[model samples]
Target: MAEIQVNEDEVQVGAETASVCPACQALLSDGTIQGKSVLYCTKCRGLLLPIANFLPLVEFLRTLRRPTGSDIQPRDNSDADRHFTCPQCGKSMTGHPYGGPGNVNIDTCESCSVIWLDRNELQRIVMAPDHYPVYSRYDSGGGLRRTN
Candidate 1:
């Protein structure tokens, strides 16, 4: 496990003493999205999310999606050419298209079980057309409500 320290402008990884952004090599800052903790790069707007937290977040997002009449699209290998090293383990991370309805490519570090999402990737997933189970779900009369 990596110990994370979050100050006003930077995040430090305890064992290594530094946690730089995978996308921009800039220092990362601690941040939260939908109340889930993450390390964010101010320069690149990329995010580093723990797999433990991300899985539940994805499950919650899935609950918001309307049932798809069709199956998900097949994944593409266009992102395979790009590679990233894990900030925690210093091993090469695997890049693959996210398995959800969205087409964003995400990087995962198997050793550390962390994920790296580039700028706007999360927004793309959240705004995907298939994700709108019903716009009314956001209204007071609906059963669902935004948490963060």
Candidate 2:
């Protein structure tokens, strides 16, 4: 089993099962990042995450992460065209730019219901500015309430 350090206070113990990374073809180690289970590639620092956990993981990380005040770097347009085989299912993964804040490209294997994030991609998404649209509704008393 492999042990990974998440931070000063948290240490992630690897699972007994072994898997390979789809990005770099390196061994993927099981561990938790921000309390969510994930298969992490130590070589390329990529992450293989269950589709169900992706949103929750992003939300949790964004909540804990503050803006670094550094300029947001642009994502590589070519990455959106790259494809990879799913490590779990051996199927072609769909690559696309995430429709969220960070402008990061993500690869998903719908057959296996998994998402792949390259090195620093998670951090990019969390650090990107939150730009959710705000909606306003009128209450029973005609008072405007903001929803978002």
All-Cα superposition RMSD per candidate: 10.1, 10.0
- Against the reference, the lDDT scores of all candidates come to 0.65, 0.74
Q: Where does candidate 1 have its weakest 10-residue lDDT segment?
A: 8-17
Give lDDT tens digits, candidate 1, residues 45-128.
777889888767656655655554222222345666787888778899998878775567889999898999775565456445
Runs in model 1 with CA error above 4 Å? 1-17, 58-79, 131-148
Across 1-148, the per-residue lDDT of candidate 2 in tens digits comes to: 8754674212264763457787888888777876788887777878888989989888887777756523344566768777798888888999988888776899999998899998678877876667533435655654333443
Model 1 Cα displacement at 11 (Å)?
A: 14
lDDT of 2 at 54: 88
Supply the global lDDT for candidate 1. 0.65
- Report the C-alpha displacement of residue 59, candidate 2, in angstroms: 1.1
Error of 2 at 5 (Å): 4.8
Cα error, residue 20 of model 1, in Å, equals 1.0
